[model samples]
Target chain A: MEKELKKIEKVISNLELNSQAQIQELLKNFLKTHLKKSKIDNFIGDYPTFIEPVYLNVNVKIGDDVLLGPNVYIGKNTEIKNYVEISNSIIFDNALIGENVKLNNCIIGKNTLLNCENINIDNCVLVGNVKTKEDVYRIMYKFK
Target chain B: MSEKRKQEIQRIKELESINLARDEIRDLVIDTKKEVEKDNDLLAAQINDELNKRGIKSIDIVGAIGAGKTAILEKITEKLSKKYRILVICGDITTRVDADRIEKHNAETVQINTGRECALNAYHINQVIKNKDLFDFDLIFVENVGNLICPSDFKLGTDKRITVVSITEGEWVIEKHPMLFKMSDIAVINKIDLLERLGTNIDKMIKDACGFNPDIKVITTSAKTGENIDTLIEALEL
Candidate 1:
């Protein structure tokens, strides 16, 4: 029985040392290597917010505080500002994210993000492609 | 060397081979997991938000030229626009003619004549939504520039996509313009009242619609006479 245990240990040790699979090897190395917690802050700014503490993952970076939905997917290296609310979509990084916006199936810009509120995206990609001097607004008008 | 020793050595070598392969597979799974994690996280966030505030949803309506989309929009908005918060946008190469007609329905409308159609993306749709305050509206409707080609390649960021087809065009529409039907999430047979006069077979049309999306919901309607328009409304409302 002792010999069998030794054999099993040997198999595990062998697996630990192998690196044939690229991602596995990367993950293995990540596991085996030392890791330091990133200093970058990713959090919802607290102050008169509807709900506190937008659910976050290890990879995302948030500003002071942002209102977030349950399925908001923040990609690696994303930097979200305070007072931003995102729901149901992938938000990529350094994204100058705006406040009070809802998104879905939308890929924000590599460098493009909006600061305007009351925006919603569906199955689309917005690069903040062009710089504008005017702030976009959606207002209600009374029929005369 | 003894046979036993030789056999043990061979077993070790076999184990080493397995270890190599296992490591490789493990790495692949880890990479895949990152993507899946992102997807899962996004889905999780959406669910959390949707549950909390009821939900903010948008719908996209697409069709080919002369599909009578504007006519149908007239019927839809007249009956249900006020009941549901509705935001409307019209697309044409260089004109807001359709938007003018649709605007008569009393929905806040945006006329997006980009001159070029290639730029239609999630980003563009997002802009329109924001500009139109579409999210604030109960139902946001986007009327594509009457072309099935360029629009299909880009996602307009709507929750559901309904493709419109008219019977006056012909029964061969499904067989010829399969891509248009194939790309949309739902297939709508517009101008169905013209079936008998135009020799358009409703069953064959249904079959053709199914060829692209077997589960596709088809409604035969005539805005002219208000036939089966109720079913169309039910499909959209549901």
Candidate 2:
């Protein structure tokens, strides 16, 4: 079992830089090759939420009024405030998102505070602890 | 040796090679910069002599990203384009957005895409000047890449170095990046209009700049409202 786990670790490390589609295909292949049919069926039945579009890898606190779009990754201990809409974005751990904020196609850095109201952010990689209400356009230029 | 021992030896060798490669790259970058600085010193002297002979003026504007460097340039160009034949060289890692904006103000503009370079070296300025007749223009402005650190290290052969810091960048920015202020002839605290909204202490920022460099001329401006722009022009002797 230890040897088999080591083999899986090797595959995962090798596929670290690969595209999402490629990684998913490789993971599926690995699961098919390693797991028994009955075990796979039982695992799928027990954790039926695995097939869902929204994948919550860790414990998150989301408000009831918040709306999340497809392919959202909310990290552990993040507070999604009321009326916030997030889509195609990865919100890192320990972030406090404010009310009525709209984020799309962005990577919210760890320990960030998106406390701006009615702000629309897109294609932005906000650094940790970025406190701003102004329009932050194409912030990737700063990183580069 | 056992299989595990052999694998450990291979891993150590790989790590050593990676460290050696990193050291070599660091050395190469340092040497290249030293050589470039030497070349730049000579080129800058030549550019200065030529500009002095033609009685023309030049200014290099440096600041962090979103610190209102481009906006300040646009405001300055709009005010002086009628009196002086102006030329602006906009430098950035990518995109000609600033160049397009400056061209709209009736200034002859050129865009320098530096690829991965953080600052515009004197070689870039020399090349741009060589292609154009410097005698045709009275004032030249070079809007450097939006970097507070790297741009301070490089001199792009300008008469005045203006560093623009906006209120949006936080108050501690002036104290944090004192080298930029030390090198700059004029330090502009831009986006003063946002002061009430951001609650940034403008007097403290100016005092910090002055404290770092007593000779550095400081101006508080709002490029959006055109506030204290004439004061900036006066400071530049334009």
Candidate 3:
């Protein structure tokens, strides 16, 4: 687990980390390294919490047990699944959020998905039409 | 006289006639604008006197679309509605979105749909005052149509005129719309939360505004964050 974390850190340090694509790559690697330690099960049954007021820029469907943090803006037609945590981020239109996901300080672009369970993301912006966990892995592998 | 000499004279006469006509048209345009301004000023003075007699304070808020003009008004309304009986006259090209928003805060609202008009002129406010019994209201806020150019040209008979400019519109916004800043009593630099993220120098913008209108009062605020909203109310003395 330490070796995997070191590799993820090395990947993040090597990339030109200004753009959203690089941030997404970093988040994916971080999540993959953490997932290997079987932390996914520990995040289950955690109730969603909102630390600050959530601004709904458009009609957004937020399922039960979703935790929205301060200064979070959810665009129209976005669906946040159950037991998801989002904070200080902007989720654009038509994006799908799978259950048991954690997002912090990230921007989720239109029509994207964070379908992976028990993932924690911070200071990242996921762009393009990211649909599945395999897609995230593929992008992260390219960065590596 | 010779035929060639007569032709030259005729040409000169026609050129002189065209110049005279052009000068007359220019003078007519200038005179017409002056007359309109004079009439507007007269009406504005009348409205001001009327409001003063009734012990009502009035202010006109002007800014570009998405410059947080409505949001600033909403914030002001939320804060002032508890103490003052306020009337908000929202000027829009079509919808009553702003008026409806202010009404939600328990303020009396009147929507003036100025279709194809860029600003609310003195006549519009005059008509509304004539139609409504405004004696009960302590304050009146006339939200001009969302345009920086035309709204500055027309005085809506308010005691104070405020122009809201947001940092998200970029640093050159103040320099681009100097006329609005020159005519306004106060200039509000809004959306300060995006100042660092947008890499905008709020001080520079304030300096440019002062250069445009040295007497203009400048305030920085973020309506979304409810920052400096109380200071704005205090500046307005409402």
Candidate 4:
């Protein structure tokens, strides 16, 4: 029984580390390909908001004064409100991103309504009905 | 194995269990969304039957905030009131300001205050008209809550659905909101008088609208200047 338990631990640890590395690699390549095809148009508003250094799906409605990219992917029908800065993130479709939020290295899930303001999310996978103003952080290393 | 090693195995086993449960939860969510859509469709068909029986033609107008949905409706009411008994139903987050504005143009107005709800669903419309005599009007205009995303998912039991956007919203508005264009019967590009000053390419917007929806009718109008309002009326057949 003890030998079997040790083997299981070794297998689980290896699987966790390998999956994390593989996901990071896949997401990086995906964002790189999509960013090359993204078109940055001048968002003509009072504040003059433009998504610089980001890859955006054409169906995203972005508000004024939002800073996006270097490595970001926003999917279709996602509405980003004013004064939000996001970098190195993947926001899925139908997400209602509220105002004054900052995100870095985050993977926001589909149909998630993020109503938080002025909160910084880093190195997290916020998924499935995450509607709160509290600062949330879930490091990816926990899977190991 | 050591004490810590045993705990690690147990934790991995639990994590696998949680992952399986998460997949089930995701499936449940998808099923619920489809169920809601099916219910909305059934309700919309019922409402359409009711409206048809009463000889009332309904239109649901959807757009982003400040996209001139109200301006187009105001112009529509002004022109068609002399010929038809029009009823304008305005859906707002928390104000009757649009209802008041449309009422001035000789249309009976009803205000639906959908507090914090992004979209006006068919169930709300069914309840709104259930108490009223819908036969008194020949046409009904429903201005859905000002949003580009949520309103696209709803069906308001209307004969025609219009998605309105203005040049000031940006030249990419049409491409940025593909779902609304795909579902709408008519796409109105308003505020064209300011097109040159804003330097927006109206052609690109029209092309994008047509690309998403080949069957959709695209009309460029300046509601402020009343340009192409007559053409829009003709398209609406009002």
Candidate 2 local lDDT, residue B150: 93
Model 1, span B121-233: residue lDDT tens: 45345444432322466666778778766666555656667888788877777667776677566677888677767877768878988887776788887877878777888
Candidate 3 C-alpha lDDT tens digits along A1-144 = 346434434444445544446655544444433332111111222333332224454456666656554345566678788878775555666777787777766666667766666666666546554556666544432212
Q: Ranking under TM-score, best-scoring first?
A: 2, 4, 3, 1
List the pairs of residues colliding in candidate 2. Answer: none
Relative to the unseen true structure, what is the C-alpha lDDT of residue A68 in candidate 2, on a scale of 0 to 100? 51
Assess the local accuracy of residue B58 in candidate 2 as a C-alpha lDDT between 0 and 100. 90
lDDT of 2 by residue, B148-176 (tens): 99987777778999999998998899999
Highest DockQ scorer = 1
Each prediction's TM-score versus the true structure: 0.48, 0.58, 0.56, 0.57
Off by over 4 Å in 3: A1-144, B1-24
Give the Å shift of residue A125 in candidate 4.
52
**What TM-score should be assigned to candidate 4?**
0.57
RMSD of candidate 1 to the true fold?
Answer: 22.7
Candidate 3, residues B1-238, lDDT tens digits: the string is 9999999999999999999999979978999999998999899999999999999999999999999999999999988899999988888775567877888988987766554567778877876675456776999999988998998778878999999999988888999988889988899999998877888988889999999999999999999999999889889975
lDDT of 4 at A39: 40
**Runs off by more than 4 Å, candidate 4:** A1-144, B1-24
Report the Cα lDDT for residue B203, model 1: 80
DockQ of 3: 0.01
**TM-score preference between candidates 3 and 4, better one:** 4
